[model samples]
Target: MNHDSYPDSYIRGILNTVKTIAMVGASEKENRPSYFAFKYLLERGYTMIPVNPLRAGEQILGRHIYARLSDVPVPIDMVDIFRSSRHALPIVQEALTLNPRPQVIWMQLSIRNDEAAALAEAGGMKVVMNRCPKIEYGRLSSEIAWMGVNTRTISARKAAASGGIQRLSLNRASVPGGATEAAAAAERMERERGSAG
Candidate 1:
């Protein structure tokens, strides 16, 4: 796996598969990027565990914060490193200690450690460097595109509206650009409704 560039399928697969994410270096402040990502993924149905030594034994968004990876009670599907690049190796080493190690180790944007990625990959885990899972999820699911951000890809399929926000799925089966049968049907139905009104 190349660390410089990632295929959309690879990112989408991980995003679709992982259910539980442990965010290392998570912050309590709402203005922090880690907090924002945690909130976004949590709202999208991912179980978010905050790992911050300073805030240990406390709760962030109702989820208990643990001081270290070993402190987490349940199995983690992914370890999202919100810390700096220099701290990645030790964090990856700790993640490798898990009995059933996480399937992925994701370093946040602007945080890349080739040594950490090499170690995690050597442990048979998929490693993503210098990227944000929250951004990837939104991009692959067309959630960010709806927010007026150009994702460099176009799709005619309308997102499933929930709570007045349009959201799409990364189910892998559905093709982009309204190619899926269900998407086509929904497009037609929306057109008819527009005509009727």
Candidate 2:
């Protein structure tokens, strides 16, 4: 697991498998990166739980905010840390305490701690560092390319237009199959959970 680079399949696998994500350090500010990311992932259909100590007991995008990961009532398939690298260790430490620990520990862009990654990995969780899941989803799904951004990925198949919005799946395919793939991914995740449990 090289933190330097990740395979497209690995990222696609994660983006496809994860259903609920707990975004640590989520902010209420609309202009903040975390806020933007939270909104994006939510729109993309991932159940988002915001974790902000100061904003606890409040709602961000209609979802209640918790003071800490431990305070989250639901199982978090992935924990997306929007905090700095220095705070990553303690955050990972806390995430490790969950009854069914999160399957993934993701550190946001520009935030990476080898020690934290090691700790999470040692706990049997997959770790992604210095990457934004929002951006990864866009890139892997070819959504960024719709915005005229160079995703460096070329596909032979043209995406189907839905209400003038081009939505592609993680495997670089179009809609109808994306939904099926999502179902399959969920089944796979459940099977993995069954074996692990």
Candidate 3:
């Protein structure tokens, strides 16, 4: 089956509900996409557990590295696979064995396996193939649009207001305040992205 696209609501719902994610194929190298993407999620208020069998017992971004998904002590809401397409099948297989299996299995950009995706879906886990969570989050949250990138979401809501402060949050809303506050949110995102890199 072709998985060239997914329902926005499905992806959004997953992002809204998931809190803890187990990132497989995590890398220690700061320049690696996995490294920064993991940090991006961390800064977005999600707990990211790095998983790399080769780096087991080591720490990545202050999180303990697990050798496998099953090795993670806590339940995982999602499994973010940074590995290639060929490994998706095995990875999903392992994810299914967890006591409380993850609700989602996400293969990174350039990664896709119909069989793996189908199996996970059959097991009641949502599957996202050939996509990057970092990109998805930024897109869904309209963070990229703020950078003058055409997000194609024209029906935009204003940013939310709280405690007399305006900031971009996960919820749908327009930019709350004036230039200063919008700049603040943008700067924060860039800083976190830079540091993660």
TM-score of decoy 3 = 0.82
Candidate 1 lDDT over residue span 86-106, tens digit each: 898999999999978999999
The superposed Cα distance between candidate 3 and the true structure at residue 126, in angstroms, equals 0.4
In model 2, the Cα lDDT at residue 47 comes to 100
Winner by lDDT: 2
Candidate 3 lDDT over residue span 1-197, tens digit each: 34656655667778989999999999989999999899988887899999999999999889999999988999999999998777889999999898898999998876777789999999999988777898778776677666775443433566444232222455664332233455446545543443343
For candidate 2, the 10 contiguous residues with the lowest summed lDDT are: 174-183
Report backbone clashes per prediction: 0, 0, 7
Alpha-carbon lDDT, every model: 0.82, 0.82, 0.79
List, residue by residue over 67-98, the lDDT tens digit for candidate 2.
99999999999999988778999999999999
Off by over 4 Å in 2: 157-164, 173-197
